[model samples]
Target: MNVAASIADFETLPRLQRARGAGRIAVGQIAGRTRLRTLFQEGCAKIRLPRPTGPAVEAVLINTSGGLTGGDVVEWQAEAQAGSRLSITTQACERIYRSSGGAAELTTRLRVAASAHIDWLPQETILFGQSRLERSLDIELEGDATLTALEAVLIGREAMGEAARDACLSDNWRIRRDGRLIHAEATRLTGADIERDASSLLAGCNAFATLVSIAPDAEARLEKLRPFLATLPHAGASAMGERLVLRFLAPTGIALRRSLQPAIAALSGAGSVPRLWTI
Candidate 1:
């Protein structure tokens, strides 16, 4: 079957960036100062923004029809100005349906300019067994810009007695500042690997997550969050100059979510957890 995709942008001035693919790849702009929106019946959708500032840009993704069944691909891009600040969020959790043939992929790109900031706080991603998924995030930033991101994955529904015994999952993320790579990570999970060594990969865990922050005060932020980070049964941290990486592994999805809340609040300085993630 041919892959399906779509792209949209919420720009308001010197022309925006937009691209989508559905068995075909297309690239274009939304034009700055123009507010644009599109509805996707099926296939992949992408949103791009350039030199954005002031009011934060928002996107609401709804799977109105139902869960994704076929091979669907989705991508998103957001770019901010030298002193702009932007926040990108999803209206709801992304649901991955059982794949009939190949897996689905979601790619996101974020670019921030000097002294700018971007917050990538999307809802959780639910995966069904027999499904395959690959998600990639690329962030490019200028000096003194800040980027805070979160990634959480649930293998299967415990209450439903559903387990991803034969499923496959892959996730990758990369962050660059001033054209220099600063952070990179990749995770791949399959049925055989999980069964063979559950402890090492899943650690008898059904869900896990990672939070990465890059800023001038990343070290201090890491120190402040040390107490909370220490509470995790399995956690790790590495810092240099203005960047800190944090990872968490839990036996249950609830546990993982519980541990992530305080850490995110402390680091992001948000009054409470993101509303979209309450579910």
Candidate 2:
């Protein structure tokens, strides 16, 4: 076998891109104020900033590879100690490119202490053509703790006039409070099912978002959030007990963000969205 043929043989084999990341954050007491006590990370993921923002600590997550493709693995874990207030966001959007091999996987786990407050607000996840992604999130909240999490999924690149064909996405979320499961949501979209179920499930929208807020005041704030939902072309808002759920669908990410901007700010109870939000 010649050297050129030998090298060509090696190149013909499947090429795999792999990455593993883990992050940990814990709160502690600092002069009678809650502060981060432990922050650990490994692999391609890093915590860009873990600083104090008003009454809470804000943490920004970063992925150095710029994007995730086939066979990539990513994981993040965060914990807020008792009486702590923590806010988390990503530095930019997570792009999922086409996968010729196995699916890319992502795992996230969150723990909130009693009387603590957490805001898990990351940017969108853009899916490219023929991409495959599987993700799971598990959250544990103490009896009096509060949590707010947001996720946005974009089917394709709008500016490039791309389309998501043969893409697969599976997302599962489990939320528990006081050792009891309160909410569980699972979504699976296979290759053909993407365009097949669009009319009924997604209303032909290529982009969508889900935001959940759980707190003692969640129900009481429903009235304040209703007006925001009424303005969207496609949106739904509901409050049940300690949980407030918001759903959005739009033709593009920009449209969806605009439609959800008012509701997001209202539910977050902040003057603005997360600092990581693009524009």
Candidate 3:
């Protein structure tokens, strides 16, 4: 009986502000050099490609919205066609601010065609007190394609005197080759006791990093990577078949990066660290 009036009222109702964005990129080999095939970006998600590095392509991801909070969502996708090589890194660390309610969300999807390679090397994600974040990373590989990924997290900034005692985080990663899942892991952190628990995975560490690589030479690189990891206060490396995994934990962000940078450079396709890391 009052359908029109109700519809108008609903349409005029105030809505809570939220940040939303999505970005995608595809690369293909052309005359032995990787080149951009397609690129798309919207809202706060943006992708920038600096000058090419030899035959491989390097891309930098940027979040123009600055930081994320409750009700915010962002997504990114990258593809490497057959015989191509692509490396991606973020312009700076991602910051998660205090959330009033709900949770900030992030998703990333990667595809590697036959004989292709993709390196995902985003910077650290910093979590502030009372922040909430959920992140997922899914990857698909075909034939002998390869992938190298790195994820680093800072619970709080020691230099700034910040603490993440009340922060919440949930992260999941899945990797599939030939349509079969080869790697899967989930991590969750909640409550103020996380930092103080002696048996906790973090063990009082405020910063942590993880690196996973899948390639024909992945296992071979394990030995070389071990030395770099050994120098860290808390670090480990392991290899199985074509996959290599490494983890590092430290009391401060500065301490974590001291050894983490060299380890990444050793495994990087270019055998050098990303430029943004130095900046």
Candidate 4:
């Protein structure tokens, strides 16, 4: 055997990278337009804003750490003042690498005042084989406030011929409106269970996304964006009461994004997504 032709597999001595950050923005009406009043940030999480245009304010969030692995902790928080209209998104998709120890944790907390509108449209989260990640999103909304949030997940990369069959993921969400619980959901998937029911639960797809909107006219937007969903395969769009949820599965990350852009644009009512999304 030629020694030079063989590669080393040393999982025991992997390099460790850790970072923590948080960001907050309080927006209020200035000359009848949304404007940031107070902003605070520390650690790995951040929020960047663009020049004022119209009454809606757009923000871009960043994680300077690039990616995360086991034993890492990151926190994100935001606030939307009453009558403020804010839309936020990540600079890029967040990636989680394989780990051998504790799982990475990402906790986000958001508050929306009465009559405020917030759009939490972070990009996707890609997981690598043997990766363990736990994330939770908690939102508190005042009465009559509107919220539009989207989350996407990619399990491994098909281009690399890799499968996240050994990864573990736990995603949780809790939402409250006017001090009353409105929606609470949790999804847990383990490596073994994923491999066992990949075909059934995942529907033979490698990536999936969900978009939720809560507003007085949330149900009406379903008909407005239904045509876009019709253009994609393995997609579902529905509305109940004051909430609309759009879910889709695709064989590749590109396809899922292609299917989501139009839906997000129409529902967010920004005429387009954040500037960093196209980049």
Better of 1 and 2 by lDDT: 2
User: Where in model 4 is the C-alpha error above 4 Å?
Assistant: 1-17, 193-200
Q: What's each prediction's clash count?
A: 14, 0, 0, 4
Summarize candidate 3's per-residue lDDT along 180-246 as a digit string, tens digits: 9999988788855844356447888888888998977877799877766666668988899988999
Please provide, for model 2 over 98-195, each residue's C-alpha lDDT reduced to its tens digit, 9 standing for 90 to 100.
88888888899999988887888888899999999999989999879888888888998999987685678999989999889988899777867645
Worst 10 residues of 4 by lDDT: 3-12
Give the whole-model CA lDDT for all candidates, comma-separated. Answer: 0.66, 0.82, 0.89, 0.82
Best by TM-score: 3
Q: Tell me the TM-score of model 4.
A: 0.88
Q: On TM-score, who's better, 1 or 2?
A: 2
Q: What tens digits encode model 4's per-residue C-alpha lDDT throughout 1-279?
A: 655444344434566667667777778777878888878878787778878555678878888888778888888777888889888888899989888798989888889898888889999999999899999999999988988888899989878988787878899988889878887777676876654356656776778888888888877889888777787878887788887888888888888888888878887746576667778
TM-score of each: 0.76, 0.91, 0.93, 0.88
Question: In angstroms, how far off is 48's CA in candidate 4?
Answer: 1.8
Q: Residue by residue across 144-251, what tens digits does model 1's lDDT show?
A: 888888888777776788777666778899899888988888988777754424666667677778888888888888888888777778777877888888888776
lDDT at 68, model 2: 86
